[model samples]
Target chain A: MKHLYPIKESKQCELRKASPETIRFLLDYSKSLKIVSSRGLTFESNLN
Target chain B: MELHVDDASLVKNYLNGDEKALECLIARHNQRIFNFIYSKVFDTEITEDLFQETFIKVIRTLKLGKYNEEGKFLPWVMRIAHNLVMDHYRKNNRMPRYEGSEQFHVFAILEDDGVNAEKRLIRDQIESDLGVLVDRLPGEQREVVRMRMYQNMSFKEIAERTGVSINTALGRMRYALINLRKFIEENQIVLTD
Candidate 1:
């Protein structure tokens, strides 16, 4: 749905554009997050 | 097959313990979300924090088993980022302002072809932000803006390529700038260094 827009301009409610470094850091940080399940199981995912 | 996985499936997989699913999801939407946050805060450090926090909230909601938006993942994440940006401004007690200390013309940077290396970095950053805004214009206006800014096309060339008179192309450009100004002012987006 976001890809449907022709201009790169972000819509009022839409998010747009990211730097490579930001994305890399976010992915790494996301990997460190402990995703806890409803059953109390905690898991870590490796992004590398 | 990884490229073909949609957002909803990815979210489902992430909730089911497939961490790679969230990776795929983040990769898919990171640019827009990052840009969205960057546009509001104007500072990379703040944008980085907000981006991370936005995803943190996302993970918390998903982990709680309360996820519901099936096809609206990007917008949902965008809403989170937007709220975080607003919260940041609220905490600082300052409305987000245009980045530069002086009056800066967005179109001038868009048209600048002789930028030095240092200026090139700033210009590129501005162009990227403007590129996102350019994508939001109506069809004809967007086409004119893209041709003039990206293709380096003259008004005559734009008229020929777009099959319209020079005046019509010029009118579209004018209107596009008006709309862009309105968006910038209304959103208080930081498009400059």
Candidate 2:
């Protein structure tokens, strides 16, 4: 009974209510993660 | 001033070494970015993961000054989201590949839900082996496989581009796949990518 749920037709997407705080957190996390992982730097170094 | 600022301007500001500029760009476009990820996964949890992954990659690329300011930023990030979704599927081993006509048909028949995940995993492992076998094909056959399978080109399109007849294009792909399967059986290659 499973089917492909085409997202275009469904209306309950999470984007409508994405908050500013969430955006900031994700951006910060992404930046820090990339810096730490790619440069072999410590998380503490990127946190600042 | 905020209402009039454009994406290119924000990108330039960010590239000029302004951190807040990147934040503003994300806030402006995060909704569309979120929606792009959600559209592919159809699961809130997975969408969240991919959305984050997409931005992480975007931020890294922008920081490296390789974002190509000439291109529109929204579509570029959307392309990132789409690729992240595929990578997610690939990591989960649910990304069905196009090995031949039957595999290409609607992404490998969707695999009956009744088939347990373990069975699907085994089958996918086999398919992955054939994926590696692709590189071993003869020049003409390899071109046909890449064009027809990965690029999703029709035999007619492949024929026109490769300067071969449709029949020849189809023949090459068929032989390529047949040879791959034979090689897999003959060499006991494990499919994993």
Candidate 3:
């Protein structure tokens, strides 16, 4: 089976193992593309 | 024998009013096109609409003799989707942002558990944690992951789209994976196999 989670074979393991706090921090960084996409007045998919 | 033709040839045939050729082309590329659009917007419904729109634009532009057959057909369609995504951002005057630092909070958009709130909460927590790590990556790395993993773009296509060397694109992916791995380890989160 093709592995979706192929561990990176690199020396920079420290950055790879982000703390839960750090993970939460990053999610907060980028705002929602949905809101932006919607506000742009483009066609929204009704399939959702 | 099923007449085999390259994408360009098929496109040209479609341009010449061979309607079946267009159908063949759509069958060949729809899933890839859908994945590409989904990666950019991160919404299944939006991706479906954009997927349809991408093909419509392809048909319209091809009929108008606006596309250059010098490049592969999928890339041209991808360019259309990319432009649409960019236009979306530009018109809204907003940036793509997610909340939290550790996991992906975007999963909240997927959950609705009146009876299983606890399960939903746990899943959301994990996603939020992972989302944070992914978000902290450098811009180039993040873009590469978005294209490669989310958009399902090939290294060649990504290089072409971003106007970067293929090696550079691959290197960005490599670094992105490395950083993500580190982020996971430091957080002591076990991703299920």
Best by lDDT: 1
lDDT of 2 by residue, A1-48 (tens): 235777664765334534555677766764564333356543323453
Give the alpha carbon lDDT tens digit for every residue of B1-193 in model 3. Answer: 2247778788777666676776666656666766677667776666665665566566556654568855478888889988887887686576765565455567757666564877677877867776778789999999888888768999999999999999999999999999999988887887552
Taking the tens digit of each residue's C-alpha lDDT, what string does model 1 give over B1-193?
8979889889988877888898788887777788888888777788878988898788877876667999889989999888898898897876644444457755546665676788889888888888888889999999999899888999999999999999999999999999999989988988776
Recovered fraction of real interface contacts per model: 0.52, 0.35, 0.00
Candidate 2 runs further than 4 Å off: A1-21, A30-47, B94-193
i-RMSD of model 3 (Å, 1 decimal): 16.5
User: For model 3, how does the per-residue alpha-carbon lDDT over A1-48 read when each residue is reduced to its tens digit?
Assistant: 347545664343322121334223222221111111355454423222
User: Against the true structure, what is each candidate's TM-score?
Assistant: 0.45, 0.46, 0.38
lDDT of 2 by residue, B1-193 (tens): 6646888888888767777777787877777777777777776666766777777777777765568855498888888888888788887787554445643666565666686888888888766766678888899999999987789998999999999899999899899989987987899876653
- DockQ of every candidate structure: 0.25, 0.23, 0.01
Model 2 reproduces a share of the real contacts of 0.35
Q: Point to the candidate with the largest TM-score.
A: 2
What C-alpha lDDT values do all the predictions have? 0.81, 0.74, 0.67
